[model samples]
Target chain A: MSRALDTVAAWVLGALWIAPLVYALWAAVHPEAYAARFDLAAPLTFENFARAWAQAPFPRYILNTFVLVTAILAAQLVLCTLAAYGFARFAFPGRDTLFMLVLVQLMIVPEVLIVENYATMARLGLVDTILGIGLPYMASAFGIFLLRQTFKSIPKELDDAARIEGCGALGLLARVYVPLARPTLVAYALVSISHHWNNFLWPLIVTNSPEVRPITVGLAIFGAPESGVSWPLVSAATLISVTPLLLAFLIFQRQFVQSFLHAGIK
Target chain B: MRIRDWATGYLLILPAAAVLAAFTHLPIVRTVRDSLFSRGSAIRPARFVGLDNFEALAADPVFWKVLGNNLAFALGTVPASIALALAMALLVDRKLKGQGVLRLAYFLPTMLPMIAAANLWLFFYTPDIGLLDQILGRFGLPGRNWLGDPATVLPCLMTMTVWKEAGFFMIFYLAALQTQPPELKEAARLEGAGRWVYFRRVLFPMLMPTTMFVLINAVLNAFKLVDHLFVLTKGGPNNASNLLLYYIFEHAFAFNDLPAAAALTAVLLALLAGLAVTQFALLDRRVHYR
Candidate 1:
C-alpha cells in the first residue's frame, strides 16, 4: 500500500512540475481566443508563432546569444586551461593566495559587481558590445578549480615522460594534460554554455542596442505588459527562445546532469 | 631553473589572473570606494559624500522593503527546495519503473531560461483570462491577482522559484545518494527499522554535507534569481516583490544612480560574505570529522 502511494505521489509531483512547460505548449499552439479555454475541439494554428517571429527581432537576438555563448566558452576554455594547468603543476610564490583570490569570485559573482563593472565598461568604451557581455565571465573560477582538480589527479609520471620528449610547458599541456582531462573540459564547456546563455542581469546591464542584446533581454522587452502582452504571441516567443537549450537538455539529459554533478563536486 | 619555472607558471596564469582582477577583485574594491561618493549628474559632477549613500539606504523604505523581501524569499525557497529535492532524490534512488520520464519532467524547467519561464508563468498569472483563473473558475472560485497584488506577488514568485530550483537541487542530492553505501539501507531494513526511522537517523545525517552545499547555493540564488521579476511584476505595485539585486539594477540602470547602486551592492556583498563564512565553517567541520 505504501509503495503504491509513493508512485502516485511521484507522478503527481512530476506532472505539477512539468505543467508550466505543457501550458506554454498549449498556449502557444492555440489561437489567442483559445489560449485559456483549452477546448479539445479548438483548432490549433502556427499563426501565433509567425506573428511572434514578425513582432520581435528574435533572429537577431538568437544570433547575439549564439555569439555570446561561443565567445564566453572559447575564452573560458583557453584561460581556465592555462590557469588550472599552472596551479595544478607549478610551485610558485603566492600561488595559494592567488588561488584563494580566484575562488573569491565564486562567492562575489559578477552579478554583485554589476554596478562597478558597468562603470569600467563605460570607461573602456565597451558598453553595448558583445565582448562586454562576455568579458566578466570569461575567467571562471569554478572552471579553473574543476580543471585543477582533474589535472592534479594525473600521475607525475606523465609530466616527466612528456618533458623527456622535449615537450615544453604549453606543448605538454596541449598534448598530454588536456587530452587526459577531456571529460572535465566537456563537462565545463556544457555548464558554461548553458550558464552564459541563460545569464541575464549582466547582459541586460551592458547591452543597450538590439545588436548586442541576447534572447533573454529581448524576451523581457517583448513580453513586458507595457509592450502589450498577448498571451499566445508571448508564449510562442518564449518557446522559440528556449527551444534550443530545452532540446539539447532533452537529448543529452544524462550528460547535462552529470556535467553539473562533475562541476559541483568541488 | 628555478626562475625559469616561475616565469613559465606566471605566464601561464597571466590571462586568467588579469581578467579576474579586472572584473572580480578590482570591482569589489571600486564598489566599496564608489559607495562613499554621490552619483554625478549633469548639473554636478560626482563628489565624495562619505557614508551619505549608506545613510540614504537606511532611510530608504524601498531598500528595507526589498531587503525584507529578499530575506523572506530566501527563507521561503532555501528550506522548501532542499526538502523537496531530498524527497525527489529518494524517489528516484529507488528502482521505480518509468523513473527517467519523471526525472526529465522535473528537470525540464531548469533547462529553460528564467525569462522564458517567467513569460510562461505570466500567462498563468494573467487576471481573469489565465490558466490558473480558468481552472479556479471551474470550481466556482474567484481569481486572485497573482502578480499584481503585493500580498500574493512574492509568494507567487517563490512558488515559481521552488519549481525551477528543486530539480536542480535534486541532482546534487542524487549524486550524494549514489555515493552512499547501499549496505546501510539493507542493514537498516534487516534490523526492522521503519523507513522514516532509517531516513531520519541514517540518511539525513549522511546527507548533511550535500545539504549544506545546496543550502548555500539556494541562498545565493535567492539574491541572484530575480529575472522572473523583469517579466512577472517589474517589482511592481509599490516595489512589493523587489529583490536586492533587481533593486540595484533599477537604481544603476533605470535611475542612473551609480553611487546608490554601489551602496546596495555593498550590502549584498556583506550578506554574501556572511554566507561564505558559514560555508567555510561547515566545510572545515566536515573535513575535521572525516
Candidate 2:
C-alpha cells in the first residue's frame, strides 16, 4: 500500500509540474478558440506557429543569440583555460586573493550592476551591439572556478613529463591541461550556452534594436500585454523562442543534467 | 626562474583579469561612488550629495515595500522549492515506473528561459477566458483577476517561481545524493528506521552543505529575477508586487533616476556581500567535515 501511495504521489507531482507546458503545447497547436478548452477531437493545425514566426524577426533574434553565446563561449574557454591553469599550477604571490576576487563575480553577477554596466558599455561604444551584451560575461568566473578545480586534480608528474618534452608554457596547457579537462569544458559550455540563450534583463536593458536583441528580449516585446495577448500566437512564439535550447536539452538530456550537476557541486 | 614563473602567471591571467576588472570590479566601485552624487542637467552641473540618495531611499515608501516584498519572496519561494526539490531528488533517484518521462516533466521548466516561463504564465493568469478561470468556472467558481489583484499578485508570482525553480534546485540535491555511499541507505534499512526517520537523521544532515548553497542561491535569485514582473505586473495595482531589482529598473529607465538606481544597487551589493560571507563561513566549516 505504501509503495503504491508513493508511486501515486510522485506521478501527481510530476503531472502538476508539467501541466503548464502541456497547456502551452495544446494552445500553440490548436486554434485560438480552443486555447482554454480541452478536446481530443479539436482540429489541430500548424498555422499558429507559422503566424508566430512571420510576426516577429525570430530568425534574426535567433541569429543574434547564436552569435552571442558562441562568442561568449569561445572567449570564456580560451580566457578561462589560461587563467585556470595559472591559478591551478602557479605559485604566484596573491594567488588566493586573486582567486577570491574572481569568485566574487559568482555571487554579485552583472545583473545587479546594470546601471553602471550600461554606462561602462556606452563609454566603450558597445551599446546596442552583441559584443556589448556578451562582454561582461566573457570572463565567466564560474568557468574559471570549474576549470581550476579540474586542472588541480591532474597529477603533477604529467606537467613535469610534458616539460621534459620541450613543451613550453602554452604547449603544456594546449597538450596537457586542455586535453584532460575536456569533460569539464563540454559541461561548462553546455551550461553557458543555455544560460545566455535564456538570459533576459541585461539584454533587455542594453538592446533597443531588434537587429541586435536576443530571442528572450524579442519574446518579451512580442508578449507584452499592451500589444494584445493572443494566447495561441504568444504560446507559439514562446515555443519558437525556446525550441532550440529545449531540443538541445531533450537530445542531450543526460549531459545537460550532469553539466548543471557538475556546475553546482563545485 | 621564479621571477619568470611569476610573470608568466600574471601574463596568463591578464586577459580575463582585465575584463573582470573593467566589468565587475570597477562597476561595483562606480555604483557606490555614483550613488553619492545627483544627476546633472544643462543649467546645473552634477554634484556630490553624500548620503542624500540613501536618505531618499529611507523616505520612499516604495523602496521599503519592494524590499519587504523581496524578503517575503525569498522566504516564500526558497524553503518551499527546496523541500519540493528534495522530494523530487528522492523520487527520481529511486527506480520508478516511467522514470524517464517523470524526470523530463520535472526538469523541463529549468531548460526554458525565464522570459518564456513568464509569458506562458501570463496567459494562464488572464481573467475569464484564461485556462485558470475556465477551470474554476467549471465548478461554478468566479474568475479572478489573478495578476491584477494585490492580494493574489505576489502569491501568483511566488507560485510560478516555485514551479520554475524546484526542478533546478533538485539537480543539486540529486548530485549530492548520487555521491553518497549506498551503505548509508542499507544501514538505515537494517536498523528498521522508517522513511521519515531515516531521512531526517541521515539524508538531511548529510545534505546540509548543499542546503546552504541552495539557500544562498535561492535568496540571490529572489533579488535578481524580475523578468516575470516586467510581463505579469510591471509592479502594478499600486506597486503591490514590485521587487527591489525591478524597482531599480523602473527608477533607472522609466523615471530616469540614475542616482536612485545606484543607491538601490548599492543596497543589493551589501546584501550580496553579506550572503557571500555567510556562504564562505559555512563552506569553510564544511571543508573540514567528513
Number of the predicted model whose DockQ against the real structure is largest? 1
**lDDT, residue A94, candidate 2:** 95
lDDT of 2 by residue, A1-266 (tens): 87788788889999999998988999999999898878899999899999989989999999999999999999999999999999998888999999999999999899998999999889999999999999999998999999999999999999999999899889999999999999999999999999999999999999999999999999999999899858899999999999999999999999999898888887
The sequence of per-residue lDDT tens digits that candidate 2 reaches over residues B150-198 is 9999999999999999999998998889888999989999999999999
Instruction: Give the per-prediction TM-score of chain B.
Output: 0.96, 0.96
Q: Worst 10-residue stretch by lDDT in candidate 2 chain A? A: A1-10
TM-score of chain B of 1: 0.96
lDDT of each: 0.90, 0.92
Candidate 1 lDDT over A1-266, as tens digits, reads 98888898899999999999888888889988888776899998999999999998999999999999999999999999999999999888999999999999999999888888988999999999999999999999999999999999999999999899999999999999999999999999999988987888789889989989999999999988899868888889999999888788888888989999988876
Local error of candidate 1 at residue A13 (angstroms): 0.6
User: Model 1 Cα displacement at A109 (Å)?
Assistant: 0.7
Q: Candidate 2 regions off by >4 Å?
A: none
**All DockQ scores:** 0.84, 0.83
